[model samples]
Target: MKNVIVRGYDIPAKTMVIANIWAIMRDPGFWKDPEVFWPERFEDSDLQYKGHDFHYIPFLSGRRICPGMNLALPDGMKPEDVASSEAIGLLFHLKTPLQLKATPVF
Candidate 1:
């Protein structure tokens, strides 16, 4: 490993890199009304859901995409039926836990 420079900062060799995804996603400069739970902001976005863009990096992309990305709702549940309310703090929590029945698809 060798020294590297990023955006004018000199990073020592073999340094660990961590992305503050929460801050980046809520950056006012990159998003308008970022605190609001607005899904429509992406309606006109050209960015692919696969995290091709850094502005939004949900579970990353490509070979490093989250393993849980394949998780799906139980049968008979629509997206709109899911609760969207959130309680923000040091960590985000669902204002109300989602109520659902888990029925085996098999």
Candidate 2:
């Protein structure tokens, strides 16, 4: 019914659309200022990460669900230990400074 420009080329539009989730999530119709990283958006919302919500599907959904589901990683090391190790590793290996803020769970 219309022409959709893809990669600078005009393609004939059809009843169905084939688009990646990355593009769909950024669609203005679904989100306002989609380009901005607003973690607080989910702070007050009932948005889900367990594949039930469509607005935010971080781990994908259905057949393509993540294989690391229900994973319980070992906790032999403390949170600070892991954070320090990662920060130091990045500083040495990648020559980048890792910013980390420690906070109590309670």
Candidate 3:
């Protein structure tokens, strides 16, 4: 059901087409006044990123869909908020060395 033949040509199976998601979502052929930002576009509509609906595929669809996508997406908490639990594991490893001068109190 994935492959489709058109004009004696095959689109192939499991092909990675470099499609422009921005343009596709704004195309007038499929949507009316598509350039507008309408969150209600999918209101009561079957169009979804659950795989079959090719129009919108955010985390993708089918078995390859992102498993942790339903985390609800947050803006992230400050380091001070979770100081005990949070840890920096980045790759770039950019930091400035600090110098300290301390005196012991009696």
lDDT score, candidate 3, position 100: 33
lDDT of 2 at 67: 65
TM-score of 3: 0.38
Report every candidate's CA lDDT: 0.73, 0.61, 0.57
lDDT of candidate 1 over 1-106, digit per residue (tens): 8899999999999999897878887788887887887656665978767645764454456787767545667688778878888998998988867765545758
The TM-score of predicted model 2 comes to 0.39
Candidate rank order under TM-score: 1, 2, 3
Task: Select the stronger candidate by TM-score from 1 and 2.
Answer: 1
The superposed Cα distance between candidate 2 and the true structure at residue 98, in angstroms, equals: 10
List per-candidate RMSD values in Å.
7.8, 10.3, 14.4
Task: Give the winner by lDDT: 1 or 2.
Answer: 1
Q: Give TM per candidate.
A: 0.50, 0.39, 0.38
RMSD over all Cα atoms, model 2: 10.3
Distance from true position, residue 37, model 2, in Å? 1.0
Cα displacement (angstroms), candidate 2, residue 29, comes to 1.0
